[model samples]
Target: MITEKFRRQLRTEAKLWQTEGLIDDYLYQQLSERYQFDALEKTASSRFITILISLGGILLGLGIITFVSANWQQWSREVKALLLLTLFIGVNTSGFYFWRQQNTLSNTTNKKQKLGYGLLIFGALILGANIALMAQMFHIGGSPYGLYIVWGLGVLVMAYSLQLASLGVMAILLIGLGYLMGLSAVFYPGEFSWLQFIIEYMSLVAVLLFIPLAYWCNSRIIFFLATLIILLALEISLFRIFDFLNHGLWGAIALTLPPALLWGYDDIILPKVNSRIFQAFTRNLAIWYLSIGFFFLSFRAIWQDFILVNYSEISSEIHWLTLVEVLVFVGLTIWEWLCLARPNKRDAQSWRLDLVSGVILSFIVGTAILCFWHLSINEIPEIATFIINIEMFLLAAGLIRIGLARGIRGTFWGGLVLLTLQIVSRTFEYNTGLLLKSFVFILCGVGVIAAGLWYERHLSLEEVRK
Candidate 1:
């Protein structure tokens, strides 16, 4: 997406180009019309006003809430219920009215629209309060998380009705909050609420509920949050059910599975749906996952623990739920891989361009083999450490290469940071002298500056060529 700042800069440059006779009036007009240069100032002003109004509304709402809360106990149930209903209806009605208001000769600004959106958001917050107050009035009792879940569901319905991304994001946060809080109740023996069912299969719920909404709203934020929720839910399920298994296996799966899914998201998941909107996000997340995972693995202490852990004490009994969940995701991944490979697009140049994916796949395989070796045969800690260090270095180098090839600054810097961190971490981790540490730090600093300058120059050249 072209940002407002970029558009503004382009507008200035276009004006300069026109003044210098580099571009004629027609071309300049085309650029102006396409970028809506004339409306930028108006849009900025509208946004500023909207922020001010929203802030004021928040303060006013807080005051009203505080006043109501102070005298809440003095009111009769009938009066209280009536007041709540009236407040909810009145606010939402006003919001809807303003939201649908047309701009007339007398009203040129988007203040009404902004005000309506803010009110709608405020009304949504009021919804949760109303639920809590009504419940309190009737003395209906359940877990706090259950209340949040219900509140979230209500907001979600509102989001669906209005197709508002803000409300959708709010709903996801509320539901996520409830889900996290409900984790405590999962292990506690207590009376079951229907919400327990939602908590149990939150991954499925998040996918079914939010994924469609994400596509409907065309919101990357929603998609990102939904993806994270699903991944976290699945990971939690695995840990909860498979806690009796070897920790090494858990570590291996945790390290490898997410990156694999994310790295192949475009190829495996998007093709079926015929959309690549989230490909970049998934790939970046995969890179981050691998980078962090490899950083941890590069430590000798972690490998020492892996080699020392007794696998024989682990339970052989299986939990069907966890097994099915694992099998489903693993099977899906494998099936998708096969489908992706069925096409005859495997050329040398294609392979070279996809060296990042190749490296990730190799890392996954290598990790699995390492874990299995530790389980099945005796292994040297140093050897494992050395192998992990090599893998980490390769990953960093791959990131740098890919970044340079693709001209992505973030990717390049990510790789640089990872490489620098590795060097520094190793320096501190090993029995090195102060002089050696100082020397290493200085070398890393110089290397970083040099690399950054070169990359910036490369980007400038690319831009010029374009």
Candidate 2:
């Protein structure tokens, strides 16, 4: 993530220090060697080449389309079909030829490999176009979701056969689009009944298919996208199966699953997981979800909405999906706890991190119990606001504590930002006058600045001591 310019500046500083005898030449060499400065420049060059190749491919595709359009009037149906099939096969064959050469040819250079990659990318696009053109030529009916489903499956086959990460990503996107289209059709008024358009089931199928593909590909981008699709599918299933927009259910999910992932991802899941891509995805995804979800819950209006909306209409219907989600959550929670507790008492702190996860686990478990109790008694929503406020503050405080202990600036700033946002939001929500609001804003800004300075000074002192 570090930029080339920054790396260059760092190297220059190291040279200056060496020349001035502030640091030894050996130390300077170590500092210079610590960062892969060449990587940033190489990545930049690769991206530029990719962009240029993409543009050329686009222009070439357009040229072919123009020629085809000009000759369309004279071509018969059979001719058109034959032409489309020929182009599809030809593009893919050419791309594969180049890609194979790039990998196998001993004399092939980086430029040749990039060209191969570009051709493959262009071929993938052509494959999609070919599918749509064929579908149109045959007069295929029904929702566009059907077309997407077919196209996605086609790309998925290619992805699996070729073991291409880009193709895997494309397949996921296409399938997600199809799933969304299907969901829309199922809910479309007067056009289709729920049973008539069982599109949501495709989401489950997608999860089953893509999760394995992600692991197989060992691509973090693909894995992350798959995970998101799974989450979306699960949420949609919750909405459809429950037949109510019960905030309590969502709240329970938000509280338990994200925190479990955030706190136990590295300690529990990383040890068991083989794929570096999956581990990275889990850690980052958990961090973002927990931060954003907790911030959203800090607002009082959210709790008010949960209290105001009634779920009586679908209260009698048994939601099997809810049970599934709960079971999965519980399973993950138990697994995390077991992993955290497996070590001896002597290594407990190393595993548990000052009982931080223990506290988060306790809170999530308590929230889950309340969620189930509220399902029956529905009393928690009435007092949910106070509980959520307390949770938000505590979560923020915990993050700050962890950040300070670990010396992670990002986490520390994230905690400060969340705390500041909570305070600012509550301040403005009240019917305070302009003068009071101005004073409050000033107070917040000054307090934040002072705290930041103090933390920076503390870090500097620690560095000096080291």
Candidate 3:
């Protein structure tokens, strides 16, 4: 899809070309027709008006809510119930009517459509209020998260029916909030509620509920969040189970597995289903995971602490649920490797490993070896720390290299910052003299400036070549 900025730029360039006599009036008219130059102003004005209408609607809704709350205690149960039902039905009916009217009337401005969308969102909020007030009137008691879960599920149903991206996002947030709030009850002794069941299997539930919605809405944000929820849930489950085992094993799995899964998602999972829409998002997430995970692992203290932990007395029995989860992910990871090894049909050359993939694979292997050594010999080698530190540096350099090659400033700066942080951290972590620390800091500053200048030069050269 063409962005508004691009369209505006194109329009300006087309006008310049026409003025310079590079294109005839007929060609200019064709360009105008193709890009719909006349509609740009309309779109901008409609957007401004929509924002005003939405803000006004919000204020009006807030005023009505406050007024009702002020006199809510004076009303009887029957009156309260009737008012709640009427408000819910009336707001939703009006929103639907306006939404349909705008669609049916092509001559109408988008202001009505925007108003309809805002009202629908407001109706969703009112649904939650209605749920809360009705529960109070009926004297129903339960965990607060239970209420959020029900409210979120109701919103999710609306989202599915309407296929509205905003409502889908709202539902995800509500459900995620409920899950977070209910985590304490999951660990501590509490009264049983059906919501607890949902909380326990939230990872699977998020996948089942949000993944399809993401595809249905064609929303990258929803897909990213849903995947994040799944990864977090899996990590939490792993840590809980491995709290009894050697921390090294679970930590390695937690740090490596998610990124590996994300990096290979397109090849291993998506290809079978014939979809690549989310490939870029998954790879970006993988890079983020690796960068952060490697930074933490770069510290010597982390490895030393892992080595010092006493795991002999811990119970060997693993929870069945966590075990199954680990097994499934491990199985998928192995399958991904197999797929990567297979030759591509479109290309004669075998699948070549990219720098990022190589770095990730190396880190995983290094971590696995370190954990295994500690497990079998009951001692972590000093070389293990060195290996991890080297991996971190390599990852940083790799990111910078990839970024410069691709002309992505964020990736380049991300690597530069990571490299600088590692240097600064090491300088502070060790008992170095102040003079040496100051010298290192100065060197880092100079190095960063040099790298930035060189990157800019490289970008300029590439643009010239283009």
Candidate 4:
């Protein structure tokens, strides 16, 4: 894990030692060879050159875009399509030439290589614009999601063909946006429904396309980005599909998805993926999701909104896609549980089991409170509010404990901050007297200051001991 900069520093020290006669010429030569000091020295200037080359490519792209905009009204339909295609092919061909031309040189960080990468980026942008503009020119009618989906697919093809991580990242973003737009469009119907197919299997399509690209590009960022988008699309799609908002099924989802991700991470995801970055990103995301979910559910008004409001009877229409999603989640959870039951895995502290237990408890509590409210229990809301607030507090405490066990400072602070926010927010939200509220606020401030001082003192003592 020796970085290039550290290698260079080591090389400098070796050279100084050789000059002072502390190390022999043979040792210095060996150090140079081992560290590739010669290569490092040349690359020191290559990054600046790369940026300059990339800027040139960007400027060239802007010029083309400007020319097209200015002459748009002057071009015929056929000519417009031809012009877009020409720009797409021409820029990509030039990029390929610059990239292949660098094969003649030994240095990998040459200006030509950078220029090629930049040109490829510019070409990818052009390809996206081409898809949208051409669709408009052809009088094709579809949702914005359809246009983006087409553009994203085009960019994805380029990324896979070139195996460029940067392009792959761009493709992932475009696809994610397309999925989001499609989800939004579902709520707000447009003039056309032709593009609904893209939204139907959005998560599945994104996973299938981008997961392979992530592997091909050898980029952990792309992999996790893809995973995040898939989860999001699944969440939204499932919410609508199940009609969860009407039945308060959001609580079930909020409680389950985080644990499911964690389970997938441990049993299936990590074994196949060789990226620490992806693992860390997923783990943090799970913590944040759970924390936010708990904090959101802590409010009494939320429960009232779900319970007090009269809901209309939703149609019994079957949604096959939603059924598939439900089955998939169930199947995966069962599969993970079976895997964990293996002899070797039995000893492991299972995040899935912990999460399942909590989810079951939350579900029971929520159902009980709802039932009580239905049965004319006036005190149901009060009981539910107290239990939920307690649940939030315990969840925060559990997060801090898990963070301590994992030695993650961010998670620990995140949990503590959540706890603080809940307390402060509730104090203001409730109809407490002014004097009582002021006293509670002052008490919380003192507690925080005292806790800070104690933590500082503990850190000082630990440093002294070290």
TM-score on alpha carbons, each prediction:
0.79, 0.73, 0.81, 0.75
- Quality of model 2 by C-alpha lDDT: 0.66
What is candidate 4's lDDT per residue for 246-336, written digit by digit as tens? 4434434434554455433542443465544454555566656656765765677766676444322432233476557645765665565
**Given candidate 2, what's the lDDT at residue 214?**
70
Which residue pairs in candidate 3 collide? none
Instruction: For each candidate in the order shown, give its overall lDDT on alpha carbons.
Output: 0.79, 0.66, 0.78, 0.67
Tens-digit lDDT track for model 3 on 1-466? 4566777999999999999999999999998887778988988878877788879978998999899889989989999999999999898888877776633223434546666787899899999999998999999987788888899999999889888888998988888888889886645535655687677667768877998888888888888778878887777666655565656566567656788878776623553346678887888888788778767767777767853565334333444765676668778777776676566888797666665566677777777777666555666546766777787788788889889879999889988998898889888988999999999999999999999999999999999999
Which 10-residue window in model 3 sums to the lowest lDDT?
102-111
Alpha-carbon runs more than 4 Å astray in model 1: 1-71, 102-109, 187-191, 247-251, 267-273, 306-319, 344-354, 376-380
lDDT of 2 by residue, 242-339 (tens): 34545556545544565564456542254355534455456556666665765665556665465345544534343454456545644665676677
For model 4, where is the 10-residue window of minimal lDDT?
309-318
Largest TM-score belongs to which candidate?
Answer: 3
Stretches of candidate 4 exceeding 4 Å from the true structure:
1-24, 27-82, 96-108, 188-194, 215-220, 241-264, 267-280, 306-318, 345-379, 449-466
Q: Write out the backbone clash pairs for model 4.
A: none
Cα misplacement distance, residue 415 of candidate 1 (Å): 1.1
* True lDDT of residue 105, candidate 3: 25
Per-model RMSD to reference:
5.8, 7.3, 4.9, 5.2
* Top candidate (lDDT): 1
lDDT of 1 by residue, 270-340 (tens): 43466677777887887787788878878888777754554333433434655677666666666555544
